[model samples]
Target: MTTEPREPRATDVLTGLLADLRAESAVLDDLVAGLAPEGWAADTPAAGWTIAHQIAHLAWTDDWAARSVRAPEAFTTETARSFGELLAAGLDPVDEGAARGAAEEPAALLARWRAGRDGLLTALAAAPGDARLPWFGPPMKAPSMATARLMETWAHGQDVADALGAVREPTARLRHIAHLGVRTAGFAFSLHGQPAPETPVRVELTSPDGELWTWGPADAADRVTGPALDFCLLVTQRRHPDELALTAAGATATAWLPIAQAFAGNPGKGRAAGA
Candidate 1:
């Protein structure tokens, strides 16, 4: 005589994800909202990037996501020319976005980022549930798009937290980051020039609140087991794999740990073991 949990309706997908995205962004905003101008200029772990760069990167990417959602055809036309020019000049379009946004006055940048991300949330909510939008890597539907934004917001928020010497309380939103990490295991291998394995790898993580989260077949031969936070940080490249306690039981999972990337585009050079 037990009742099972009800499954989420299809309509709840984007609605729920957008809410999580907003909450994560708000958390980061709280961390930086009252920073002195010097705080904005402080260096983050991303080498040359300052705190301003982190927020700017989020804003810039949010704007791009809005454009893609509102107009996919136009998005393609616009990115093809601009991205090509950036690549032709040996510059990464992603870096270019951060550089440009980071140069804005702190107050102005903060305001613009708030507006841009709010606009993106609106656009995402209005999109057809099954409609695909253009992206830097693969096209994504509204829900996946929102989840990706949440993942980046949390990842970059970690950098800001580290820079400010603040300790953030890990929350349930980290579940989004953990899920993206597991989903991108194949992409990690593909990006590193290996054939993506046909078999799925089981991922079991202990969440912040002591809940268990999992992905893939329960009986899969390959497996990744760790705290959800460590897995999230590893996939986001926020910390070196060696710096975390993640365990990989099979060849594919072990190889994936070093290259796992939740974000799109080329893999980052990554951090030293204890950096």
Candidate 2:
């Protein structure tokens, strides 16, 4: 017998997303904690950024996100000040900020990160059910913001793992990242200066637990099917589409794979095939 699709409840989704966010943060914390002092200086896949830079960036972002949720006016004021300082120093805001963070002693950086993480989690948990928080791009509701945090933590954690020549076990939390990738397909296209196609595209992923997680209209003419891990890697620009086992049918779906991005920003130049 055919089973009906289970509709997601808002409360359940928010709870699950928050739990996954905490889990992701914990995993990253553990990874960094186990690293040797030299490991912090090791260069990661993102050219020029060391493991320390990755952790520092995460910390800085978490602190900003917490401020955004807890105090809008202060967030705006501090963001402008930070940006102005970066410009005055003749530094790229993101790169210079991360570098400055990385320059701190490892223990101090870790402590700052932990504090930021705690603050962000507390603020997110206390946000109103429908409250929206501003980000570098458009504003997002608490749930979406939390999911973004999870996705970034996972992606940056991959960089740290790779830098240390360590392998990470894939987890079910990847389902959220994959869902974000699919949900943002249109935004990805728009970021690349193309009008998003109107054609519906089905996404079918085999979860790490071997369960099927499907999104979009099942009968859609365009479709993407693959392992959820690979989908996450592609969306995060960690793996080239050519290096993955994903398949895309129809013009829009095919075009999307190379440019798929889960995070909000400029269209990233994805990794070269097998890089």
Candidate 3:
């Protein structure tokens, strides 16, 4: 008997995303769990950032995300004042957050990170399905927020892996990141002071397991095609476009490859080719 798979409900989709979020976090935890105290100070690919900075940034961001879900008023008040002021003055709130978090002792930082991850999962699960959480960028629902978190986790984990000369096994979890990249085309363009095309670009990638993952119109003139890992790495600014095998078939797609950012916040300078 052939039974067709039912379309997933919104709740079910969000649940699956949350599960993947947990798995992504667990992978990073496993990567850093055995690090010595001094290992935390080792430099990662991100300039001036160390292994501890990577974990600290995750913990700090997770704490804020939980607050955004659980305490909207507080999130609003703080971001409007503290973060707004910093950004208005041309300072980076993200760098400030990372620096402050990185000052904590490694053991204490690790414990706080673990506790915050558990707390964030609980808060996200408890939030009403239609409720939008406040954030540095536009407000997002639990599912989108989970996807964003998963994207950051994997991107930063890449830095950590590079620093340690460890190779991470790509997983289906990257689908969330690729989806975010596709959805944020307009936002990415706007961040770079460029106009977003009215017509969306088609993205076709060969996934880690060799399945074709696609987004956008079937016959879009603008297209990005490549290995899914390369696309993910490009969108996250973890790898330079010149160092990757991704192909851009139109003007918009060609311009986009250089400035695509899956996560929100400031436009990244991105990586140098062969760096």
Give the worst 10-residue stretch by lDDT in candidate 2: 266-275
Model 3 over residues 65-126: C-alpha lDDT tens digits?
99999999899998789888888999888888888888989888999999999999888888
lDDT of 1 by residue, 96-128 (tens): 899998999999999999999899999999999
**What clash count does candidate 3 reach?**
0
Prediction 3 global C-alpha lDDT: 0.91
> Which residue segments of model 2 deviate by more than 4 Å?
1-9, 84-90
Error of 1 at 232 (Å): 0.3
The top-ranked prediction according to TM-score is 1
TM-score-superior candidate, 1 or 3: 1
Would you estimate the TM-scores of all the predictions? 0.96, 0.93, 0.95
Question: Which residue pairs collide, candidate 1?
Answer: none
Q: lDDT tens string, model 2, 1-275?
A: 99999888766788788888999888888888977789899998898899999999999888888988999778888888988988798887788879989999999999999989888888888887787787887788989989999999999999988888788889999988998998899899999899988999999999988999999897999999989999999999998788899999999999999889999878888777755
Arranged by lDDT, best first: 3, 1, 2
- Cα lDDT for residue 109, candidate 2: 95
Model 1, residue 264: distance off in Å is 0.7
- The models' CA-based lDDT, in order, is 0.90, 0.89, 0.91
